[model samples]
Target: MNQLRDPCRSAGRTERGRTRARNEDAFLDCPQHGCWAVADGMGGHRAGDVASQWVISSLAALPRQSNFDQRLKAVRHCLRILDSRLGRALPLNASAPYAIMGSTVVALLLEGNRAACIWAGDSRCYLWRGQRLYQLSRDHSLQQQLMDTQRLTRQQAQSHPAARSLTRALGGRQPLMLEVLELCTRPGDVFLLCSDGLYQGLGLDALGRALSRGAPGQVVDRLFTEVLRGPAADDLTAVVVQP
Candidate 1:
C-alpha cells in the first residue's frame, strides 16, 4: 500500500500598508477547499478595492469538486466569466490610457499530490522546497515583455517609463489571457501567493528564509513584519500553504 500525502495547510492576510489610501487587495485562504488566491485591484475612484474584493469573493464561492482537474477547470471558468462581466461594465466611451477597473489574480489549487496555479496580471505564486524558493508565476507586465523579447535584464527593463504597466488583466480593453501551470506537490512543500506589494518589498532571500523555518501562520507573520519595516507604498497581501 502507498501512503497518501495530507491536504494543504494555509494562512493569509492583507494590509493597506503605510502609504495607500485604501487597501485594494484581498485574499482567499481555504485549506478545506484546497484553494487559495490573492487579488490586487487596479483603478481609481471606481474602487480598486471593490474589484479585488469581488475577485476573491467569486473564487470563495466556488463549489467543491471531487477531482483536481474539475477544480482546475472551475477556477479557470470563473475567471473567464469575470473578465467578460467586468469588461462589459466599462464605459462605452472609455478611451486609451484611462484607468480601467480590473484586478490581478494568482490562485493555487491543491488535491492529493497535484497542484495548479492560475493567474492574470502580476500577482505571483511561489514554491518553497528543500530550503529553496522558486517563483512559479510570470508577470503580465511590460517589464516582463521587454525581458522576454529584447533580452533586457530586469534593471534595464525597469528603466522603461511604462515598464510597470500591466499588459493583461481582467476588465482591460483587450480580452484577458489567463496562464496556467500544473505540477506535483511533495510532502512538506510550501507555496506562497502574493500581490506585487509584498514581493516587491521583500527579496527572494528574505522570503526563502521565512519559509524555511516556520508554519504557515508564522511565515506569514514574518513576511508582513519584514515588508512593513519598509515603506510598503502599496497594498500588500500574502497566502502561505504547506502540504
Candidate 2:
C-alpha cells in the first residue's frame, strides 16, 4: 500500500442559533484523515441532534485508507449502513415530518492534489479560487428542483412554500444516492463545507471575502461572525479547509 500524508489544515464551528433550543448540527475537522464534514439534522424531527452526531462520529471513526478511492468508498458505505439502520428504526412518515430522524450531509475528502465533495440534501460544499466563489454541490431540495427542471430563477424557486423541503437526505424514504464531485486542487484553493443555515444567512460576497483570508480558522471565524450578526433562527455548522 502507498501511504501518503494529507497536507491540509481545517477549522470548524457550530451554533444552535438564537431561536433553536438545541443545536442539531455537527461537524468533523480532521485534517490528519483529510476528511471534513458538516451534517445538519432534520429540523422538526425527534432526536435531530443525535442523528447529526451519528454522522460526524461515524465518519470520524473510519480507519485511515491508503488512497482517496478507498477512503471515499468507506465514507459512502458507512453512510449507507447508517441510512438503512435509521430507516428501519425510525420508519418515517412523509405526512409527519417530526416523527422520525434524519440529516443532510456534506463531506470533503482530500488526498494529495485530488479532492472529492460528497453530499446529500441542502448542505453545501463551496470552492473559492481566483477571487471567485463557486458552489460545488447542488442541493437536493425542491428549490433546486424547481430551478433545474422548471428553469425558474433562484428567486422564483425560493418563493414556493416547499422551497426549503429536502428531496434527499440520509434516512430519507428513498435509498441514499449521494452526489460526488471530484477536482484537482490548486495551490490557493479554499473549500468551505457548511449546513444550510450558514449559507442561507450569508451572501456569496461575504463568503468569498471570508474565504479569501486563506486560513481555515480565520475563514471559519469570519463566517460565524457574519451569520450570527443577523437573526439566526436555525442551527448552523461550518468546516473550512485549506491546502
Candidate 3:
C-alpha cells in the first residue's frame, strides 16, 4: 500500500430517532487503535440490542497489539467466539426460546498506508478521497443478492419489495461469512462507517459536501442534520475517520 504524510482525525455518534423506543445501534471509535465499527441490532427480534452491545463490547476489549495482521486475526477470533456463544444460546432461547437477536456489523481498520474494511449485513463503509466519494463495502441484503445474480439491475433493486431485507447478520442461525477488503491508503482520505438508519434518506451530493469539509466532527453533524430532516425510522449511527 502507498503511504501518505497527513496525520489522522476521527469522531463518531449514535442517536435514537423519533420512532424507536430504544436505540439498537452500537459503535466503536478507537482512533488510538485505528479501529472503528458500527453495528445495528435486528429490530424485529427480542433482545436485539443485547446482541449489538455484545459484539461492540467485545471489540472494545480486544487486546492491544502492534502487528496489524495479528489485530485482524484477533478480531476474527473474537467474532468466532461470539458465534459459538450465540449458537449455544439458540436452543436455550428456543425452549424458553428467546427471540433470535442478531446484528449487522461494519468495521474499519487503518494502519499507515493500509486500510481494511470488514462487514456482514447492510452496515456500510465509504471513502472520500480527492474530492470524490466511493462506497467501500457492499450490502448483504436480499435485494443486493438479487442484483448480484443479475436478476435485478441497480435501479430495480432500489424499488424491490425486499429492498431492506438482510440476508446475513451476526448471531443468526446460519454461519457467518465475513467479507473483508484491504486497500492502499492516501493522505487526506476520509472514511465513513454508518448504519442503515443514517443513509436511507441521505443524498450523495450532501454526503460529498460534508465529507469534503475540514473536520470529522462537522461532517458527522451535517450527516445527522440531513438525515433527521426526514423521517428517522430507526437508530442513527456514524463514525468518521480521516487519515
* TM-score, one value per model: 0.94, 0.95, 0.92
The superposed Cα distance between candidate 1 and the true structure at residue 122, in angstroms, equals 0.6
Best of the two (1, 3) by TM-score: 1
Q: State each model's C-alpha RMSD to the native.
A: 2.7, 1.9, 3.0
lDDT of 3 by residue, 1-243 (tens): 222234368889999978899999999998777789999988888677888898899999997766778778888788777766765555654456645668889998888788889998899999999999999999999888889887788789878887888888887777888889999998778999999998876887887888998688989999999999899878999999988
Deviation in Å, model 1, residue 84 alpha carbon: 0.7
User: Can you write out model 1's per-residue Cα lDDT over 21-109, one digit (the tens) per residue?
Assistant: 88999999988788899999983535678888889999999988767888899999999898887776656654644546788999998
Among all windows of 10 consecutive residues in model 1, the one with the lowest summed lDDT is 1-10
Q: How many steric overlaps are in each model, in order?
A: 0, 0, 3
After superposing all C-alphas onto the true structure, candidate 2 shows an RMSD in angstroms of 1.9
Candidate 2 lDDT over 32-60, as tens digits, reads 77899999999987788999999999999
Error of 3 at 33 (Å): 1.0
Clashes of 1: 0
Q: What are the runs in model 2 whose C-alpha is more than 4 Å off?
A: 1-6, 91-98
Q: Give the deviation of candidate 1 from the true structure as CA RMSD.
A: 2.7
Consecutive 10-residue window with the lowest summed lDDT within model 2: 91-100
